[model samples]
Target: MDENGKIDTRTAKGQATRDRLLAEALRLFAIKGFEAVGTRELAAAAGTNIASIAFHFGGKEGLYGEVVRHVAATLASLYQNAFAAAQAESRAKGEEPIRRAHRVIAKLIAALAASNRSRWMSLLLQREFITPTACFDTLYEEAIRPCLEEFSQLVEATAGLAAESLDNRVLAYSLFTMASAFSRNGNFLRFTGKTGYAPQDIDAIGRAVAGFIDKGLRPSA
Candidate 1:
């Protein structure tokens, strides 16, 4: 079509526009909180029209849900990949399942630390926990509960414990709590002089958490 004859794809441009909109919307939601943002404001922030939001995502609430789901799905995929890679590595090295679980946990923490969206998800999750919203059910059913269940099974199997045992459930909750706390409040704790761990100190904290949970889950002597 031109002197150089370079083809321009409409699909690619559309995808780019959608991604840009999502990115801007997420940033605004993170800064202003979801309830504080309106469709017109989101559209302007995204450098698009209000109609674009409705066309691309149905409506404002739909856009918000999609954003949340996008971030959740990304985090879930990262965790799943980390778990699989850890398992493969452990098998190659002939490491015990318990050690593999610890390695997986460490990998998860490192992955979370490296992800900006994961950090935002953690903040959003903490907010949800404190002030439950209608979206809470969707998030719980779609993301949180499934992750907890999978993690519970993994922890129980790694520990050589019965899955339905009280100790196993308690250990699962403790590990989940520790992980969520580390992601949500680790920076705040360091800022307040309560804990000195730096943002990049995931390995040390991971090891400590693994040891603490391991001991807590061990069968009574």
Candidate 2:
């Protein structure tokens, strides 16, 4: 509200500018931690002036907080629908739990491949876990937890473990770590060797990733 007690509204252009700043901030922050980056750098990268950050996000620190929320929400929106469809297909077909798990993992891997295709948001997400901030808990709760529950459910079904058990959570985290590794360091991985994994090769990469996860979870008997 302004002095007149009227509600404030952001114009379309204003919102676009704010979003652009967030995008650039996320990219730079992913490559270089927040403390290392300055407001001037952000303005230069975002094509806006330093005052704009304070105007839109309150300040540099505030922008960082908003960036976390934006990225977390983005991941959820990007994957939740895809996940739901995979789950529905699995249930309708009465697929074996392991097969269903394979499908889920494959889809997840395919998504991961393209996650960093157009933006740094995906890498930015991975960076959070490496050096957590105040927003980590919110990210975990609003985005990570739901996704983890789904993966853990599949793992539990495949492994005959109870829900949310220590074993299940550990397995889930392990799977997550493996799944997110490629996107987090896709360029570095490519530099090391092609490894026959390319984000553009969605089906091939999905099969490879899903197969790896499935085999890793196979029963001893």
Q: Which stretches of candidate 1 lie over 4 Å from their true place?
A: 1-8, 131-134, 158-161, 185-200
Score every model by TM-score. 0.78, 0.85
Top-scoring candidate (TM-score): 2
What is candidate 2's TM-score against the reference? 0.85
Q: Model 2: residues >4 Å from true position, as ranges?
A: 1-10, 115-119, 186-188, 195-200
Looking at model 1, which ten-residue stretch has the lowest summed lDDT?
1-10
Clashes of 2: 0
Q: Candidate 1's error at 192, in angstroms?
A: 5.8
lDDT for each residue of candidate 2 in 1-221, tens digit (9 for 90 to 100)? 56897756756678778988998888888778889899999988989999999999999999999988888888776657556877788889988778777787677666766644323666777777778889888778877788888888878888877776998889888877666665665574577676655546667767887888788776668
The digit string of per-residue lDDT tens for model 1 on 140-172 reads 776677667667787777776676788677777
Best by lDDT: 2
Task: Score each candidate by Cα lDDT.
Answer: 0.72, 0.77
